[model samples]
Target: MGSEFAEKVILITGGGHGIGAAAARCFAEAGARVALADVDRQAGDRLSEELIAHHRQALFVEADVSEGRDCKLAVERVLDTFGCIDILFNNAGITRRANVVETTEKEWDAVIDTNLKSVFLMCKYVVPVMASNGGGVIINTASGWGLVGGKEAVSYCASKGGVVLLTKAMALDHGKDNIRVNCICPGDTRTRMLVEEARQLDLSTDDLIEEGIYRPLGRVGEPGEVAASVMYLASSLASFVTGTALVVDGGGLAGSA
Candidate 1:
């Protein structure tokens, strides 16, 4: 175990699976006490056990991040258990694969609340704790589609876009308090969410996976890769970095022309 983050406490939303789970493991491996908050109690508890089995400090908090009360409660539990939050990974999000017209009001609200508002809610409570503690790091998970646009993913794109901008705004507001806020815009990553996105679009999983490899990197990214990026942004190595959207998208957004 590395001690880079030995005394740090990292709270991750959506910590049950995919990139969120990968990030929890990564931070724990680096010696950080990790708080896993997710709507799925089973997955969250399972991951916490796995980490504890490895002798890592870990806690699982069931939370629906979209709700302010849940976000507040999750932060409170982490603070009570870990002392103070040194880092926060706002990785909770959902996707609604539909064009604007085909998208219903509820679907749009759900995506926005989960993907964007959760970041705000988490920050709303965590920022003060971080500020009083002297300083901290926050890394949000945006998407490549957030920077650009995607067909049949209006709600997803919009929500992620909001996240990207919200990250920047928070960074600007919190830099004075020594809180660094940054977001990663990943390309097609191999996650349950990605698989479900294909299903929503009525596409074969094999076909979708195959198409993902057409990017410059010639392969879809794994959750671990994205987790690594989050780790970087959360570490002191990025002390001077803030208000930036770090793209980890295998160059998919690179113009073909």
Candidate 2:
């Protein structure tokens, strides 16, 4: 496992923080050259520097992933730096916690475009490169809510649900090309995104995370935990695995109602 990705290159969206950042560190530790793309330039640059300081190969690209042009440029920049991308993690995402009635058009578009469309945009550019290069891995970040509905997040639920099917469709289409596509359905994890979700609901991060305490594991997840799942999906261990949503929520959805 340590040497499995020694010379491979990984391009990660949302790689500035949270699960993306955590996964970047894990891959770097495994000897992969990592390219992080994020709209948050400061956070992205900081993480890249941190990884370099630790003797890891890392690059940061400022990108608004929801747009096609930016996604193309991001892929181009990564290829320019790393030569090839063996894995593409479409992990950039956002959430708007609101029911249909409360979710504005802007909010709905933001959630859908970020959570779902970004996956398609990135794949549109990277898939051809992977195909020409022989093969590659794609790990998308869908949520447990994508499998089950959330109380006040209609748009988020809808977008993630789209991701689930989109992942499958891509897997079917790309399997012949030897390009594996899968998505992770993680339960509540401790990350900046969780903090933003808490803010949307007017609850403290601890209070929000407490909602996940009833899961069998009885705790919110750490970003590294979810990142571990990402590693598995990207690794050869899942060579025969594609189109599946590997849930990493510590049983968060085992008892979903």
- RMSD to truth, every model: 1.1, 1.2
Candidate no. 2 TM-score: 0.98
Best by lDDT: 2
**Model 2 regions more than 4 Å off:** none
The ten-residue window of minimal lDDT in model 2 covers: 204-213
Please give the RMSD of candidate 2 to the true structure.
Answer: 1.2
Q: Against the hidden true structure, what lDDT does model 2 obtain?
A: 0.93
Backbone clashes, candidate 2: 0
RMSD of 1: 1.1
Model 2: per-residue lDDT, tens digit, 1-257? 45898979999999998999999999999999999999999999999999999999999999999999999999999999999999999999898988889999999999999999999999999999999999999999999998999899999999999999999999999999999999999999998888899999999867878877788998999999999999999988999999999899998778754
TM-score of 1: 0.98
- lDDT of predicted model 1: 0.92
Query: lDDT tens string, model 1, 96-202?
Result: 89998999999999999999999999999999999999999999999998899899999899889999999999998999999999999999888898788888988
Global lDDT of each candidate = 0.92, 0.93
